[model samples]
Target: MTTALTLTAAPGPDGVIVLTAAGEIDMSNAEAFAEALTSAVTGATGSRLIVDLTEVHYLDSAGLAALFAQADQIELRTGPLLAPLLEVSGLAELTTVHQA
Candidate 1:
């Protein structure tokens, strides 16, 4: 069964695109997450893409992979709970990760 996940997109300061994700992100909903991210990126009016993961309670490998697929074009803002995991997974190197 697919887990509940919510994605919101909006324009940030200085023309940046911010994509906020809430709820859990796992294999069941990774594809949806990817599509949302892709849409946000494609429709963005700026070169910077910020993915806010502060409200996300959980994320699995599949979700991580989806993010990684767009790592080159995105920056990530994460909560303390997922900071270490992102670092250990080397995602921090692939993209900018701001820990909160």
Candidate 2:
């Protein structure tokens, strides 16, 4: 079943693009997540895109794959609980990850 996911892309301070996501990110909604990331990345001007996953409770391989696809164009901000997943997946190595 598909879970509830909220994606909001907005401009942050210093002309940064911020995509704030909330809820579970699994196979069911990974495509939508990927599309949002793509849209945010493509629409980004000259600044970096920050993907905030602090409120995301769960993420699966599909979700990770989506993030990996845009690793070069986005940074990640997540809570302590999800930090290890990002690190273990090697996504942190490819892109910046901030634990909050």
Candidate 3:
């Protein structure tokens, strides 16, 4: 079954583009996540993109892959639950990860 996922992008106060994701991120909706992320990154232009995943309750490998693809152009903000996975997946090392 497909889970409900929401992605919204907007400019942050720091001048970075913020992509906020809510709900589960798995194979079912990974493509949508990737597409949204890509679009946010592209729109960032000279600034960086900050992917905020604090409201996300689940994220599978497919979601991680989408994140990896844009690692160079983005930073991440996640809750404690998903921070370890980011570290173990090596994504934390590639970019900044702020745990809240």
Candidate 4:
């Protein structure tokens, strides 16, 4: 099993990119994950950002907020942020209904 949460990012066709994260996200690594998302969004423009959390088995409020913050960052950059996929296995109560 993967010992650490792996955050992988790759650009898709038409400037669209997917940031795929797996494993557990909590306070310890939340900031790093958030920074990663922030960097990804900041590095690109006028593209669609899709964060795929299908492999993410667990999450917390910090993680959820970090993800949403990425969405906001993308939008502020004029990048079209796609609907996030929180997957089926994981669950979290967040102000962002789009997450649920």
Candidate 5:
């Protein structure tokens, strides 16, 4: 079983679902993380998602794939994925970059 991920939801000024997650994202917990993120973005009305990975210390292919997949869905909603780590250093250096 994957370790439980923490998700905090607070209403933004524009009523966007601001979910904060802090922990390692890998095969062990990617599914849960993906579910929470996907649901929050898809259900939110603003169609904006800001994933803060500043606290994530580790990530695996599964985690990367999950993020990539979520990014794909967000594109249709005109929502862009804002990732701090994925930006400073692209996920390509890591494994399963083809997913991106």
Candidate 6:
């Protein structure tokens, strides 16, 4: 069964576009995540995009790849649980990862 993922976009300080994501981001829902992220970036009126993953409980390789695909166009805000994974996976080098 496919897991459900929720994504929301809003404007942030300093002309940043923030895309907030919640729920599991596994293979089942990676495409949805990617689409949402793409839409957020493309629809953004700001120069920078910030993806907030504080509410995301899980993210698999597919989800990581989706994020990586857009790393150059976005920054990431993640909780402690996912911070190390992003760092170890070298995604941290492609984009800024803010730990909360």
Backbone clashes in model 2, listed as residue pairs? none
What order do you get sorting by lDDT, best first? 3, 2, 1, 6, 4, 5
Q: Which sections of candidate 3 miss by over 4 Å? A: none
Cα-lDDT of candidate 5:
0.57
Where is model 5 poorest over a 10-residue stretch in terms of lDDT?
A: 73-82
Query: Ranking by TM-score, best first?
Result: 3, 2, 1, 6, 4, 5
User: Estimated TM-score per prediction?
Assistant: 0.94, 0.96, 0.97, 0.66, 0.62, 0.92
> Compared with the true structure, what per-residue lDDT tens digits does model 3 show for residues 2-94?
899999999888778899999999999999999999999999999988999999999999999999999999999999999999999999999
Error of 6 at 3 (Å): 1.1
Q: Backbone clash tally for model 5? A: 0
Instruction: Point out the worst 10-residue segment of candidate 4 by lDDT.
Output: 75-84
Evaluate residue 12 in candidate 5 and report its C-alpha lDDT on the 0 to 100 scale: 56
Deviation from native of the Cα of residue 9 in model 5, angstroms: 2.8
Q: Per-residue lDDT tens digits of candidate 2, residues 1-100?
A: 8999999999988789999999999999999999999999998967899999999999999999999999999999999989999989899999999888
In model 1, the clashing pairs are none
Per-residue lDDT tens digits of candidate 1, residues 1-100?
8899999999887778899999999999999999999998898745789999999999999999999999999999999999998999999999999987
Give the better candidate number (1 or 2) by TM-score: 2
Q: lDDT per prediction?
A: 0.93, 0.95, 0.96, 0.60, 0.57, 0.91
Location of the lowest summed lDDT over 10 successive residues in candidate 6: 40-49
Which residues of candidate 2, in runs, are more than 4 Å off?
A: none
